[model samples]
Target: MNFLTIFARNLKQGPQTEAFPLGPAFTPERLRGRIEFNADHCEGCRICERVCPANAIRFAKTPDGMTFDCWHNTCVFCGNCEFYCPTDAIHQTNDWDLSHVNADKFDMVEHGLIPNQKCVECGATALNTAPVIKNAKPPLSAEEYTELRARCPKCRAKYLKNRKVPA
Candidate 1:
């Protein structure tokens, strides 16, 4: 085909690129974009930190409790942390708009804190996270669950072991 003919065809087709900034960008359902952390659902396990290849996830001990931080700048978005989290505490969101200036680079972090709480029985300080009751044969009732959440890991284990099953 001649140049004029090709040019005419291209003009008729118009702009082939997406109208980003003016319109919303296409985000896939499974697109791994940003990291999200939920301290309430966390089991106080550091599996996500271990599985993160980029060393983006970090757990630090503070006076109040343990703090979790995921640095977006360092994160490779591999989704390893989300996959290895047993309690589904860490997951990825589809919002990929991470554009930022040089001044805001350090602020691009996902942070969460697991606050310390006193165990009802032992008075020992423990992270106020959801209790892991995987071994509980009979699902815990509302009252039982409330009691379980007030104890430390050791106390929780003992309570579960000594729980009397109703006939």
Candidate 2:
């Protein structure tokens, strides 16, 4: 067809696109757009730290506590961390509104993680105060080697509660 004829045909057809920043839009179901972490469920094994292909995931710990960084700007979203998580802690949420004006704001947090809260039950240390272990597996498994992994005596008893009433 001639250039003029083609141009006229194109102009006759309406724009087939969605308007943005003015109307509510729908994100596709299969479209991957964001990552999320549940800090409470995070046992700080840092398997996510190990499996990340982009080197975007990082962790830091002092005598203080632990924190995780998704670094979404650099993350390729391979979901390596999500699959490798033994305890099913780090997984993606369906909230994909991640366009941020500030570069640092892309750091999506589990937020309200109490890194400084003291262990009220024991004078020793709480999950909040300290997160990671110096050695990966201890001789005692923190408190004891149980079927459920590294759970302290007090925590275990609370978990394995007596459902049956004793006469």
Candidate 3:
């Protein structure tokens, strides 16, 4: 077509670009964006840290407990850490709005803490994470699960071992 004809046709159609800043931007359902960490559901396995290709995730021992940090600046949004986490503690949210000034670059981090708790039976301190109980015979009752959560690893194993299985 001629330039004038093509220009007329283009003018008839509205702007094809997204109206972001004036309207909500398009976000896909599976868009890999910001990282989120939930210490409560974490198993303290540190698999997320090892799987992160960008080395954005780090775990450190602190006086209070273990601390988790994921730097957004360094993260490539590969979702490897989220996929490798066995307990679903790490997740990638759809909020991809990471625009920030130079001053705020260092603050773009997702942080979490797995606090230490005293074992009810052994008086030992351990991370307050959900116990990994995949092989409980008839499934643990709420009370039994609560009791299991209150002990150390060794005591929890013992409790599970001594549990009377129903016929």
Candidate 4:
């Protein structure tokens, strides 16, 4: 209980913590660490971004395409993105060592050129998302759905404007 005794004991025990950053880092099983996005499997539903509690997930629709970004600094690692991803594109990895001096290290972003389906009517780019085009098979016939999927935004607007609805 003496100060000298305590100091001696501390000296004898040395460091009680693991030497991380120099040695192997350990993470717990099922550690919701970093968010991983698989663009191949992603349907761009934006559901993950919508369901994120921390607002760490962000989506931007640019001229090039839609980009999804996740910030580790803002993320609480709750795995909400993974849970809400309808396409199973988002995943929680076991890499919990997120420490870094540079703030840019915390950013995870995925960007790709928009997959445009040409409008069958005018050969213009279709405004529908990939998932929408893929899932548009049941109600509309195959040919009609294909044409609809290829319809451009301008053409769609014009069609809607000229459409006659029965009272």
Better of 2 and 3 by TM-score: 3
Checking candidate 1 for backbone clashes, the offending pairs are none
Per-residue lDDT over 25-93 for candidate 1, one digit per residue giving the tens place of the 0 to 100 score: 777999999999999889988998898898999999999999999999999989998888888999899
| Candidate closer to the true structure by lDDT (higher is better), 2 or 3 | 3
Error of 2 at 85 (Å): 1.7
> What C-alpha root-mean-square deviation, in Å, does candidate 2 show against the real structure?
8.6
**Clashes in model 2: which pairs?**
none
Relative to the unseen true structure, what is the C-alpha lDDT of residue 21 in candidate 2, on a scale of 0 to 100?
Answer: 63
List TM-scores for all candidates, in order: 0.88, 0.55, 0.88, 0.58
In model 4, state the lDDT of residue 46.
83
**What is the per-residue lDDT of model 3 for residues 42-142, given as tens digits with 9 covering 90 to 100?**
88889988988889999999989999999999999999988888888899999899999999999999999988889999899987877887777889998
Q: Record all residue pairs in model 4 with backbone atoms less than 3 Å apart, i.e. clashing.
A: 119-150
- The TM-score of candidate 3 is 0.88
Q: Which lDDT tens digits does candidate 2 get at residues 1-167?
A: 59999789889986657766677677777666567777766766778889888887788764555767778777777878888886667776556776777865655544324253443334345444223333433222434323223334355344345313334
Write down the TM-score for model 1.
0.88
Evaluation by lDDT, superior candidate among 3 and 4: 3
Worst 10 residues of 1 by lDDT: 128-137
List per-prediction Cα lDDT, in the order shown.
Answer: 0.91, 0.59, 0.90, 0.68
lDDT of 4 by residue, 78-165 (tens): 9878887776778999987777767566444433334546676788654354334343323445555445445676775564445454
